[model samples]
Target: MSVTLVLIDACAASPKESRVQGAVQAVPKTAVHRVVVQVNSDDPVIMKHAITNSLNLLKAYGDRNEAAAVEIVAYGAGVNMFREDTSPVKDLLRFLHATHPDVVFSACGNTIAIMERNEGHPLSLVDGARSVPFGVVRLVELQEAGWSYLRP
Candidate 1:
């Protein structure tokens, strides 16, 4: 009896081709387009620009019928933008979140703790803002996941 060998690339083969001689094949999964925007400045104008850039990217992807996710991470003095009492763009942030629910705003928890210690009072964050353990760590994680990084 002669033996036969058939090589198959799971990613290149379809489901029908995956089953060969009672063997199942696996395929590589594709990732969605994602971006991370980093903000470390206390300037309202800089913060606004970063938000605008994220929005513009989302709009561009939407117009092309492609799905994209955006995450804005704030650390250091930039975390001020997420403070309910001190944020100059609180209304704009609310409006943006209302319009684009997919957009995410993340604040550095470490920064918040430091600020609270200095001020001797609890801090209030703007609605819809989430706190992560560390903003730089978050950025690093996002980058490792194949997300594009922007510091505008």
Candidate 2:
């Protein structure tokens, strides 16, 4: 199976990112094996969009006859999605965490620190997420490991 990675560098002004990710999930193409959504914005709205988009994508993947493994990696302001307390989109985040095993959510540690300082509390992640050192490096590593990159 081929792996398709969706790199979500933009949090604002892009429904295409979510739509493409959903499309890919619906098909479950052997041409695609893995899909990664990299979020690189700091805006709360952007983070919300990323999480919402990711959940939609995962739902599509689950409904497909075949599906690619999906990972949602958050960095910069996008890291706010993980913070346990400030998550306004808690229901959606929790739903994603509960339903999909192939769906992995990652929060960048460096971004977490910044978020905590700004938000005046410790950063939090959904129960199923892993904390990575850096988002860009993770993307590079995923790409070098043969994942196709799509900036949607």
In terms of TM-score, the best-performing candidate is 1
- Cα displacement (Å) at residue 57, model 2: 3.8
lDDT string, candidate 2, 1-152, tens digits: 22233332211111112222123222223424556777776565665666666655545654553345556777776666676766655666666655554466778877777766876977557787767778777777667756655443
List, residue by residue over 27-100, the lDDT tens digit for candidate 1.
Answer: 11221467789999999888887877867776666666566677789999999999999997787687668766
Q: Highest lDDT: give the candidate number.
A: 1
The CA root-mean-square deviation of candidate 2, after full C-alpha superposition on the true structure, stands at 11.6
- In candidate 1, the residue pairs with backbone N, CA or C atoms under 3 Å apart (3 or more residues apart, or in different chains) clash, namely none
lDDT of 1: 0.73
Count of steric clashes across candidates, in order? 0, 9
C-alpha lDDT of all candidate models, in order: 0.73, 0.58
> Cα deviation of 94 in candidate 2 (Å)?
0.9
The reply for model 1, stretches above 4 Å from the true place, is 1-31
